[model samples]
Target: MNRAINCHVGCRCSHLTIEVSHGSYRNFTQRFVKAVVNTYKDLIEWPKNEHRVAEIKNGFMYGEGRNAWGLPAVGALDGKNFVIESETVHAEDWRDCKGNFSMKLMAVCDDKSKFTYISAGNSGRSHDAAAFNLSEIATVAMENHGEYFPLDGYILADSAYPLSHYIIVPYPASEVLGRSGGASAKKKFNKIHSSTRKAVERAFGILVSGRRFVSKHIYIKDTGDIVGIIIAYYILHNLCIEMNDPVLEEDNDETSNVDVARPDSFIQSVNSTAYQNGRIRRHSINPYFPSQQ
Candidate 1:
């Protein structure tokens, strides 16, 4: 089983060497992915307790440097689009901004680039903010912010995400580019936020570049199987980190860039309590950033 998994994930023409027929090889791969994902699903969950949360926060705070942003961030959040063959049902929904048929995998990862949580199988046409808002983590966080994100812990995200008390996003381009007095400080804050939030992007990069199966356009017909394969990759990604496996360099130049597509317009509702509180929270931290001369 292990050999089959390794061969399938690591090689493009894995069926050729597996000794099994092509159909059998495909079935085995699917079954293996499903089993692995089901068995190790806990490996990709949010922090269970306050102590675990603190540990993740400490890692993010001191991993790159001493309290890199002076914020208690447990992880970084982002979305990654996996290219797929055209689907028969809802095919247009699977088309992304780049005109490719794909599915989006929304994920969060710690400073060490290990995936802590993931919500897969969303259509690629969905925006990052919309996908995140509909995610289980978002619902949980909104219902009980203290349970999963205790001690004021939050995750860093890009401007493509909605700013919430538990999800810190960068200042909008308008705010940072304005001629106002605090513009420089906001810009500085954005720069630091981007640097810290890139861990999620790196995690996606590692997943795609590390596995041959992930980098190619997945030809699977069933969306559930595609989701299972994605989850399996994330599970194995964390396992590799635990086992201290060296991350493979990107052999394909096209896969080197892993940034998600940003929406043309992001409207934050000021009437929402979460949005107001998020703004206040960001304001409280913005002044701490020293403005450039």
Candidate 2:
């Protein structure tokens, strides 16, 4: 096999047995990715059926060979940044907080680390919450929560996302510590949330570490191409999961844990009715998890 093509497919090719031009390789990869994405896009859809929903919920509760968190969640939500070449139109918009020119990929994954929902091509500068709020899933979730998140179930998200009827966020660490000054019900809940939410992070790790095209800085100038390539890899990731491919050891350690900065205030405060409802729901479940010493 050609060395460049072999390496591009995530197999370590040590020797250059055949020379392949960069342009030719890139064009080939683009065509290959487009074909894969178009043929298998349905593999990365949100769970809608009762059986699938129950399976995802069970996966979350007993994931990583651990006990159930007892929370009704179908998926874990998170965002990731994919580095890209800086020479593009509106390049400044892609500059993230860490000074990398990249694009944001928001996703929700099941307990088995398979991507169930994905929204790519957002500016890296956009907050995770903002990116999610603009996603089709969020729009549909807001319009009819039961249609997506049935039986009052919600997605488990980190603090970067806002709490809503369809999404549940962990209690802010600062607020949790300040309220009790030590271990408490909220603190225990955060621990469980983090444990369960790590599934989404692991899903991203599998994508980045398994695909050489995604792990390296993409040199594409067009944002559309970049988005397509990323989404194609996500589709491939789901296919790999379906095949029960063994996850690489390094993938577990490749999880990204960037801290998000929150906004000072909201323009429409009344919209917080949902936030308050989320808080109430969280509090209602707090008693179920007794704090331990």
Candidate 3:
């Protein structure tokens, strides 16, 4: 426990480096993390029960004013890239947009900055939209589209995602440019979206800051092991939030840049199944309105 706490408190400390260099501590941390994560699987679940989802949505509405476009938003989704240094069979697969070897972790968090859903192990080379399309959350959202948000509630996502009833993205500036009042409404919506979405960034910051193993480039060889460790961290992260653990302040200026989600051309075609489904799904939901509405 002390070692894990120490790792969280000061991941870059010389003491940890020395212990890790000696071999035993590294093995110990791996076993310890795995044991704890496996033991507490119940704490980390996605698209929680209806009652829990409602409670989480209420928290978002309370913290971020009930804006019409995102009033019933229960979670914010974002992807984070973790650098890895060891060579693997699929090294090229893990190469990211930033030209680094990495693994992409797509996560959705509530207002409290706790990860409600995290899908890890996607090749960093995969675009955020592509990764999300293949994620379990997307499958669940589609399967229970009506039940997920009967009253127009949706998860907040960036523009990389196709806008649908289950997910909301800010209006593209170009779509509203040169029209009177269009720009103002677009600006207002973006502000609300950005503010609400910042919670995910904060959650990423807290995770990176607290996990020494992740704060530095992970020197593991097996992709599976690397992924397992990351899953453990996500579980631990949520546990911290549940316990009301004090968050260590991160150096905001040093945070890694969020990769721009590239729009998948195939999915964007109007005739494509994805685009058509998205349009149809969006129409099925009640129109979103600002809190005042």
Candidate 4:
């Protein structure tokens, strides 16, 4: 792969490829190096976040994991883990709570299962909301991009995220349903929500499956760079899906429930909760497409 990229740059084909030397990778082309470095500087340094923010502006609608915004859509947020040899005593202890105490990557995904925004590693023990609350996605979205996708609405999530005007979380405990509010909420869910918000699962599955990212053989001085490489893999994965590529393999980690998301239970609780709450109601405003609707 390195040889291909290197040779592509070296031979100077009309195909126009750019490379960026980051972390351990170097020796692409001068154009590639400068382009990638500038891109990296923009994303991580320049304005503190130009790459992902610009990506969202170009096509990565923050809340819509679908074709674009204003369509049937929902973004899914979840954390991904990578086990490298531990970091510093302080940082190591932070991630170390996970038995392996390895580094973790948290990200928000579009419905198509592409990363819309990613957060750098927090301790493996950090909660989803804690990581989310500190993220730059919302702040960046709020920047000047006229007529942009509304950062003003809700997105479906597993019970892990907090329910708010901009986010929807499943019933905390299904048992709480069967009461008046519970039954009503379940009815609303039937009308406007579903358990098949499956993009996050598919994304993680592809990462661990195709990239084979679950093993541990990495030596680490800076595991964050390794995390970036994994994310780059996902970008290529999404690009493959976008390019309509039919060549890909299923994730072999069928038994690896590292995410611990229970979509079945989540949906079941929505229904059960409505049964307990009151009467079911229809969605006044749908978030899906006409076909999906």
Candidate 5:
């Protein structure tokens, strides 16, 4: 953890270099890794929610959300890339059909846009909902003592997450997922209500837009360690988010200059079925407000 903190603050520590360097894992050997990981994980102290909330509120507003629980919380949950070092043999198949198959890391940030929970350890082949099913937030509440979040607290998520009684789905099925109702106006009303629930996307977007969550230069070979690194980066990213640190953002217009997503190949064109389905899916997302939820 000290290594992570030091590396983040420009200490240029050896841990960061060794972490990504070739054959570094071999240096520690597998047994050493397990001991080190257990030691570091045990020592890790994720900051409290109140401290994070205070820092985040100083920089940004909930945008469209209310001060629920008296915190300017920004709802967060994201599907992000977890770059790997290349796999040796089966790398080709693990590669995303569009490109490389980085592990997918999902997380839930709070109203201040700080990470309250992060769920890791998913293969890139998994869909967003598959990961959501194994969410830490859902299971952790039952195991840990005391109520972690306010009893009146709730969350909003995209359709990719399972609709639960605790967290609300902001967009109705059709508007969010392009799955229309079976001839009910009630569905449309639900859709209207859900449109405002998009603060999560914006929160996620800001994280990814900055290099802290996504390194501009990524090349992976699927190291077993990369998964933790990816997750650690997400946790670190949210720390930066909570800090509201000024980071150099990528210019999407100049995305060409940065490392392109490492798919073995680009998605050349929309398949006939995809083209049809994609249009329908996109049509459902806020035709009225491109920037709105």
Candidate 6:
């Protein structure tokens, strides 16, 4: 492969052709990368053990006083934008809130900076909350309801996400950005929320910093191809952590759930009751917290 790439670099073709020896270097590189990614994408599985969920919940609770924000959380949710160089049929949909042309990669990572859930391929224009709602993880969480979440445990996210029983978000801007003497109570909560959510940023930093391809502008035109590449990056990211791959630096040692069953109507009723209970529980923790309504 190295020899073929070297040959391609030596030869000057007016137009790069896939018919070259083993195809052009760019073509071969894309196929080889995607092939490896597809083969190992299964490695990026979400932990389903209740015990592991408990461990994560416990870890967050113990760390709350210092960094976790007092929320019994199993993961921190956030999103990253990736630039796509190829023009698409719906080019306008690729524009993000920041006015940049890109795609969104939404993910949930644990305290250790390992991703527990990821949903990518959303157009850049899609809001973080909207992208999350459409993710498979969200669908699973909704379907399983009480069975999925650990007791009193929820995921922590920024204000960009809607607050629910299973997910906690920061106080609203009105409370967090209040006048000098107004609603000072929410300040502490917001501080904790921001502090805990910083883990997601660190995770993205480690991911993009470690993977050169993700750091560079992605030129793939096909949405599926882009998703595969991102997933491939994630698989390698986790494997490196598991095997302690040395290509990553010491500091970068990086590298970086559930079931339920019930009758249709009965399950829906149970889910509603669970949601109400969760709301009450949240209120008990913070009476000033805003209601989802």
Predicted structure with the largest lDDT when compared to the true one: 1
Q: Which sequence of candidate numbers ranks them by TM-score, best first?
A: 2, 1, 3, 6, 4, 5
The 10-residue segment with the lowest total lDDT in model 1? 255-264
RMSD (Cα, Å) for all candidates, in order, is 4.3, 4.2, 4.9, 10.4, 11.1, 8.7
Measured by TM-score, the strongest candidate is 2
The C-alpha lDDT values of all candidates are: 0.74, 0.74, 0.68, 0.47, 0.45, 0.63
Estimate, for each residue in 1-293, the C-alpha lDDT of model 4 and write its tens digit: 43333243433432335433332233333344355434543222111244433443333233444433422333555665666665666754655555766655666666456666566666666766566656664455324323223432334555554443344554434423475754554444433343334556667776666654343433434655555555455556656666767645446553224223334454445446432321111232333324224
Candidate 6 is scored at a TM of: 0.72
Error of 4 at 100 (Å): 1.6
Error of 4 at 230 (Å): 2.7
Task: State, as a TM-score between 0 and 1, how close model 5 is to the true structure.
Answer: 0.52
- Candidate 2: which stretches are off by over 4 Å? 1-20, 67-70, 178-183, 250-253, 256-270, 287-293
- The order by descending lDDT is 1, 2, 3, 6, 4, 5
TM-score of 4: 0.57
Q: What is the alpha-carbon lDDT of model 1 when measured against the actual structure?
A: 0.74
Count of clashes, each model: 0, 0, 2, 22, 18, 1
Candidate 6 per-residue C-alpha lDDT over 24-93 given as tens digits, one digit per residue, 9 for 90 to 100: 5557667876887667666665555688787776665566446333455778888878877545576877
Off by over 4 Å in 1: 1-19, 64-70, 178-181, 250-266, 287-293
Name model 6 segments beyond 4 Å from true: 1-39, 63-70, 177-182, 245-281, 286-293
TM-score of each model, in listed order:
0.84, 0.85, 0.78, 0.57, 0.52, 0.72
Distance from true position, residue 106, model 4, in Å?
Answer: 2.2
